[model samples]
Target: MPAPNAWVLTEGHAGMESQAVGLAEALGLTPEPRRLRARLPWDWLPGRLWPVPLMGVTTEQGPLAPPWPGVAISCGNVSAPVCAALRRRGVKAVHVQHPKMDPAAFDAVVAAVHDGITGPNVIVTRNALHRATPERLAAARAEWMPRFAHLPRPLVAVLVGGTNGRFRLDGEVGADVAERLAGMMERDKVGLYVTPSRRTGEDAKRALADRLVPLGAEIWDMQGENPYFGLLACADAIVVTCDSVSMMSEAVASSVPVFILDLPGKSRRIGEFIDMLVRDGRVRRFDGRLETWPVTPLDDTPAAAAEVKRRLGL
Candidate 1:
């Protein structure tokens, strides 16, 4: 018998693509491996108004067939309509994150706890799903270890995220966080592996680099030579800014004690998630010092995949 064919739709964004790919891997499904193009005429519009295509568009040209997949999963706001369209055609659709419309429309909605959504079909998780396979981690360790071998032990991984919603991660904040991190590094005599996301502004990146350069720390931008998973796998401890849910989720998933850099006037969603982690003793807030805490690795992807399989009777 042939392996089950899954038509995975990864419109344009990297985060969406990652989630789709991760879900496909977890479900043991082989994706068609063809990119799907989505046309957004109103993407340039300001004030949060977006117009997206409802049907799946071929990466090259033309529209895809209705009921294109045994199952369809979407991660971002833009792909929700497409998934809904697939659901209308009897395709099993699972929506991840907060879709623009009513989530009840989807066959299954895997929402984070911070989204404040609860329902029978909705599986509320504390963090977004991520899969760090052993092969992937091994590759990261092999590739990144030798390059930084001469550096100090107990390396600190600083994962910087850009501004979103009410949380603004500006240059000033990066500078302040970097100052505190540098102090910790000085006391511990450990090297720093700094990685910045696309949302991280050029000014913030410059500020972090400026402060850490004088301290003899290594900095890696998203456009830099190293892949991000390598930094995450090889780091001793991770310090993540409170701006990104996905980043924090991946860090905690690594089974490392994650330290969150507190942001001023953070959004309630961010605050709620952080509070849950603290209450569970999964993470701690960095207060200008190196503190130790115990953490348990969370593997939500496997449970989510199993649930999806059971729902679809796969």
Candidate 2:
């Protein structure tokens, strides 16, 4: 018999994987996470070009084998073919992001509006899918409130991301972010809970810590347990670096006010995404100040999940 839960696959990229996992959770399905490791020539070719994609598939968790899942959700390009291979065997395939193939080939495609893909089966969203729903936030707040009691009131959550190939978020850039954040502390009397991603290099972390730490900001080294969920739930306001669309999306989903810290990047898609969110009054650009407004928590993940359930008849 097929499994009772959904199979969520990714290339182990945290941002991509989170989108798939969030959609599965929205659908009330337990997510079985799978990390794809494509071997040899298969890894070179695009997912659409693979003749027998399953032959190229292997996983660190285990080998891809029989007793297929009833549904599979994939996010990254490399993981799309695995979902497609499973789809041929009666699995309902749902891909997040542009599949780079015919949208009709999959049961459903959850694409970002910036991708510019539209089809009957495609569910386009203004914001990226994330797991910061009200239920999860409530649970997180209950679990994390006591842990964060030491931090001062009017807590500000800073979701820090670092340099990618396209963005220059180095030590100098990090220090610049710190200076902007320091303005908030000085002006609003706020306490900051900053969480840096692995992409934040040691030099960048040092630069950020040198300034932010002395200003009474507690930066998470990303060493022990992650306080991401807690910070999202408990913070009065949120500021995220522009390098990560995922961070921006998740931060906006919370009830708190969200601000995107501009970085030196030429990512057109990210720029478009930010523009749409700003136009919709969901977010604002950070300019050395903390501002609050009426917040309408984003419901894009549940919306995508509803489309998946409707079209797939699950």
Candidate 3:
């Protein structure tokens, strides 16, 4: 169970919510998740637009007035004002990611190195926080191991992400990715287990599937239960897209060898992060060659959580 006086707040964004929850669990807290929704035009404003409660949340879920909490973990720009408000009331507020507001507003801010945010209360990490602990992965492996038993040995997991502000997955890049995977299947004699994210459009998924399925690859089309964590658990190796730093981070954190596929983009942050990983031998770039090597799983979630706990004197 979580600490009675600790709460995790987010705008319900999946990535940010995961970070908050990961931190909460790291601190030995289960956390009561609080979702904040902005009221109309106020949602259009930036996180640092104004230093007030520009949004509103439903009161029907629980009593609006608070007895207040001793600790609050926040993520995303949408919850920046909430963290500020909590801090003003003497709550030990911990924020994840780069909030648009000043870092001084919170007791501690956990951000990624590529975000390039700096402040007295800031702690930087190489990867995003996630829920992919060894225990969870083991459970997922137990459940999914039988399901994938028919596939060949040396199963390669493909984690696909899609278009973002800085990158695209439409035409040339998609074709190139499919070709590379196909080449690997032909040469390496390994099986493939592919999963595409929500950001990955249907057309792009079909293109990749069309190329790989004939070669004995399986693609989870988001129909029933997701095999995401299961793939992370049982994969002999991982190939992930570069568009999502969060996804890449989670994959690299696992014991399996990780291969990052480059996309067409100008994201200096992602580039810098990948370079660091390559230098540290934590991961490799996919160049139509699939090689396996052992590496001390690259993870920073626990480190960030430890810092947050220290700051709060926990």
Q: Is candidate 1 or candidate 2 better by TM-score?
A: 2
TM-score between model 1 and native: 0.85
Number of the top TM-score candidate: 2
Better of 1 and 3 by lDDT: 3
Tell me model 2's lDDT, rounded to 2 decimals. Answer: 0.87
Model 1 lDDT per residue over 157-180, tens place: 888887777788788887887788
Q: Give all TM-scores, in the order shown.
A: 0.85, 0.95, 0.91
* Tens digits of per-residue lDDT for model 2, 1-314: 53369999998888998999999888878899989898887889887788988888789877788778888999888888778888989999999999988888789999999988999889999888988899889999999989889888788999988889778888788878888888889898898988988788888788889988898989897788899999999998999988888889899889888998898978888889989889989899999888889998876888788878888887
In order, the Cα lDDT scores of the candidates are 0.74, 0.87, 0.84
Kindly list the per-residue Cα lDDT of model 3 for residues 210-296, writing each as its tens digit.
888999999998999999999998989999999887888889878999999988886888888888889989999998778977788
Q: In model 3, how large is the Cα lDDT of residue 48?
A: 65
lDDT (Cα) of model 1: 0.74
Indicate the residue-level lDDT of 149 in model 3: 98
For the record, the alpha-carbon RMSD of candidate 3 to the native fold, in angstroms, is: 2.4
